[model samples]
Target chain A: MNVRKQFRAGSEFRIADHHPGDKPLSSGDKPADQLRVSGLAEQIAAFQDIFYAEHRRKLLVVLQGMDTSGKDGTVRGVFGRLDPLGVRSVAFKAPSTDEREHDFLWRVHEQVPAMGQLVIFNRSHYEDVLVPVVHGDINEPECERRYRHIREFERMLCETGTVLVKFFLHISRDEQKRRLEARLQEGDKHWKVDLNDLKERRYWDAYQERYERAIRETDTDPAPWYVIPADSKTHRNLAIASVMIDVLQDMKLSYPPPNPEYFKIKVE
Target chain B: MNVRKQFRAGSEFRIADHHPGDKPLSSGDKPADQLRVSGLAEQIAAFQDIFYAEHRRKLLVVLQGMDTSGKDGTVRGVFGRLDPLGVRSVAFKAPSTDEREHDFLWRVHEQVPAMGQLVIFNRSHYEDVLVPVVHGDINEPECERRYRHIREFERMLCETGTVLVKFFLHISRDEQKRRLEARLQEGDKHWKVDLNDLKERRYWDAYQERYERAIRETDTDPAPWYVIPADSKTHRNLAIASVMIDVLQDMKLSYPPPNPEYFKIKVE
Candidate 1:
């Protein structure tokens, strides 16, 4: 199956129905999958060079997932090969006091990709819906209103030449427990092991339900969502890389033609 | 001579006294210098990983130069290896109507690096000094006042844990003209060629004078300026990268110590 179509969320999609451990895009060999990921990274870099030089379109990749679902790993493994000049990765932590002074989307909007740039949102506006809905900060009607706002905003982005790719890194409860424990066991990884992650794990089922709702509400054809099985880190990277490369390829990106007049000019 | 000391602007520094085409950091071999640049890029990346993990310090790199002095190229070559998650490259263009309404530094203050992140300002608040002075929009008194404002603002940033590195990419007039002509001849590169760049080029001498004054007035120990000879693109990249690596090394960055208790935790 085409990776783009394989993992795309359908109208009736249920987060519970997808197996988080599945490796549909992998070659069934860990080393080979890792090698393939490296190849895809290089190809993505090449495409990014042209995309940047063309200097017309914008690309935004949003990663949303449960705690320990590998958002940071995906950034390093999948998008690490590209030059920093043309790519921006924004990790939205809790909003600052100043950011809270504005609307939820204000900070997100400020960081959107400009012409010929690609921006990856390590976490994104979807947090507005997910966190508020899960915590009962906003009721269903208000949640639905924000969904409409998001849809309108994304539609506007699309009309203005931004290409959107959203991903939900799906990891199972057991997998999360194992990952959390591993972080606890690895002394070197302690900095990343936030106590809040553990506190949030207690609300896992609520998060899952809210994530499903968020994905369903905002997953339009123009800004589709892909749910990647992220239990195995290698498979997670492979799937995201495959989906990203597919999206870039479908854009049919090409460099602008060289100028004939350029050939006549000589550096003095 | 150490690359850092070699390029650091002196109390008696005169921009005209520096040769824009000098390659003090290079091996006198183009390909060898290119390879060294790649090596420096990787080392910078490794240091950045630790810096990001340390999560306590802030880094701000400011690139200021004449038109076509390679601000964008410096970004790509020197900082390309960093994980996009931790680095932000902000290209400040002409102010929008809204930005112009606020104090000049208002927008700039909002974009400073938070703890454990690196931000590159392609052109920065220094523009506030250069453009107005060159165009006679501000009188000498106004320019001097703004310089004082900049110094106080920078001192505050340094005190608040931000380590600032400023680079003035020095390019000769003949080199600028050659670059402009090259851009004009290349149809593919036309998108990057702006009529305004040509117009700004007309203010070359004035801009140079203003730049010198800006650097002189603003160059303090905490936020010292390095005047890079930028005619040779390879040398420019090397010098910038060398100075940057030196700065990071001097920072003595190290990863947080491993947690002993983490090894005692077990997954459920």
Candidate 2:
């Protein structure tokens, strides 16, 4: 039997579902293509130490994943090593009445980082296509318009020196179910689980189809999507952090040489 | 010397530097008004626990202060207790060309939180009055217009269920000097301090005068300013964290009730 067939037929097989285009590098016996742990941690540590004098490029890390894929934990564990001064994290939820009155992208456009800052978006502009398509909140024609808007938006950011990194934490339905049930049994974690999440889980396959289409449609040169296998939480985090550090280190930021005027204490 | 003598001098009193009717809580041996540490820890823990479940009220925390007045440290220390899941941090710096083209508050208004989330502003809307007035970027007439605009902007946020808590980390010039020197001498810290900070220090008295006027003019019933003395870093962090906990506790946030409809199994 192939390695994919070695797992329990019904349970573990479903928990380790692999996407069509996933090409993960191997470590040993385990299919590190689905997850790699140790390599990721070492890469994250090295990036954290190479602090640039000035953050020259703005990085927008957009994380989109189903519940229990460790979005919160990824933020805390992976980015936790970074200097807070350079990082700004924003989680976009449902729009407020005031926000709804404006264009859907108005609020998001405002949160983009200035030069020298890193902004993380937990569930971002893709919602315009994903949610509206799923719920019929927007029509197919309207969704097409949104895809173009997103491409233009990302291109504008890149042209202005913003480096956008988008990630879809790809977890198998079985893994999600296992994690959700675990939350219910864990006393302290009960508050983290919601009935709505379970409802959404029933539509998991449909959502996956939508996600695959969205990735195919909107994965532009500037803001490409990296579909990460998130069944192994540690490996998923290390992968995302490794990518972030690599991009930042490539920027070669240096603090602007102190202006000569800064040295002149004036008599005025 | 009297307990208040530290703030007063021959013919010039530090308190007198304040604008008319701008006297903040007097700063003489008045012990830091702090929230109970254990209570604060508990509140933050509870916030983290229930944070994933959706709620209705959004919160905006504004931290405005002089250089080295504990803005960064307070955020790192106080919010360090809360789960980062529900809280977003925004740090605003000097404006860029696109930002400058719009009205001063245009960029800031876009980044306010959505319902049930908490947003922290490292330096907030008050920068309109603080920075522009000091640099003479706007004349008196323009400055007054901005002050009024800022008040209205904040008022709208309060009306829309955003609990706005603005804190001014008030500290003495001597204390600021001490901290800035420490940053320079500390090996790891040396890179973070910039020469521009020293230039801004020279204009300390003018900025303080501008801040006094802004606070007295705009401190409203809905969103009031808490001018906490920030000479002692530990006390400042404790005080700010306590206030945040107290505010959230007063709001009585809870997880959204489970909806069975949202949990129904779907026929794919």
Candidate 3:
């Protein structure tokens, strides 16, 4: 089956219908899956050069999920191999005083890719709707307005020279608990510890409900959102790399024709 | 009558229904009308100071019309007296080579007002839809797509803390002919004359049809389109300034509260 059709978060999607452990794209061999992901990452790097040289359209990859849902892992495993000059990674933390003074999207709009660039938002404007609504900082009507704003903003980006791919990294609650315990026990993982993440886990159900609503609201053509079963980190990377390969293949990216002017010039 | 209600080009609007020579905002005295326009300009200036000092929201004013429809004149007469720090006017004559390489809205998006500023587009992205459609450079489907892009783009801007007021300056063919003749016969007006504008007059009917369609498609609550009957330049100025006053007044512009901490500060 086409990976996009399999994982697409369409209007009819229900969050409960997807199982986190389902490895539709994986074979039984763990090393083979990782190897496949590496191969796909290389293909993406190859496409990025031509895409950058074409210099006509842009690409924006938005990764959104719970803290242990492997957003950072997917970035390193899938997009890390691309030419650094043409690719950018932005990890949105809490808004600064200056950013908070403006609308929520002011900082987001600043980081969207220009032509011929691929921008990965480790966490994006999606966090605005999710964290604020889940915490009750934004009420229902205001949340609805933000949803509308996001839909319109993304549609504009897609229409005006950008291809957008949004992923909802879906990991089960049990998997998150197991990962949290692993982090608690491992001394090396102390750097990744955040009391807020542990506190946020208390609102797991609320986050799930909000994430489902956000995905459904923004699951649109020209900018489709994919829900990836992300319990297994290797499979999560595999699934995302597959989606990127499919997206780049669909774009038909190619270098511009050899410049006619080049033939007329000679080295001094 | 409320200026917005009087001139708003909402659903069920027809260009033929609005007479170009109509002076709905006029007092039937030319010098008195001119004085009222000047008074309104001053009101705009006053409102602008508070609006700028409020330092929260942004404003975008779009003026679009046929050549010699008083677009430049309206900018000078209505917006000229405002604080230059907060007001920036952009005249988009033709897209440069770099601009053409990207989408139509790229240049326009870069010029959008940041927080607390008012930006005016003398001729905006609307021209992309208008000129291309009327000149047969764009077919129906492509024109429709451009309109959708524009609607989504403007809707996003409005939702992101920018107040949008779009005006289509309406002028009769006879008025255009008179203006063109004056530009031809007068020495001072020669600098403003463009032979392309004369050539474009041949497609006046096509242009009108496209304009009506564009207005109807984009007339929304957040970004309202006000049709200004621009036969009399002074009345045109009066109507636009009146609308701006209404919009700014609606926003309830005021400076931020005085900082209480100022009481403890002293200079050596």
* Model 2 C-alpha lDDT per residue in residues A1-268, reported as the tens digit of each score: 2222121122112322555223243343454533344445445444534433454556678888877887887777677656677677898887778776444566887888865666778777777677768876877777776665566556656755677778778887788989999999999999898889988887777677777677767777677676677787666765676566556566664456788987897878
Tens-place lDDT digits, model 1, residues A130-213: 887888988898788778767766766775578999999999999999999999999999999999989988889999998998
Each model's DockQ score: 0.01, 0.05, 0.26
Error of 3 at A240 (Å): 1.0
| lDDT by residue for model 1 (B1-268), tens | 6777889886567888899988887798999999999999999999999999998888999999999999999999999999999999999999986565334665787788877889999999999999988898888887887787677667757755789999999999999999999999999999999898998888888998888889989999999999999999999999999999999999999999999999999979
Tens digits of lDDT, candidate 3, A188-229 = 998988878999999999999998899999899888999999
Clashes of 3: 0
**Where is model 1 more than 4 Å wrong at Cα?**
B1-268
> What lDDT tens digits, residue by residue, belong to model 2 across residues B81-101?
667777888999988776764
* TM-score versus the correct structure, for each prediction: 0.52, 0.46, 0.83
Instruction: State which candidate, 1 or 3, has the greater DockQ.
Output: 3
Using lDDT, give the best candidate's number: 3
lDDT of 1 at A263: 100
Native contact fraction (fnat) of model 2: 0.09
lDDT of 3 by residue, B117-232 (tens): 89999999999989989888879988888888888778878867899999999999999999999999999989999999999999999999999999988888988899999999
Interface RMSD of each: 12.8, 9.4, 3.2
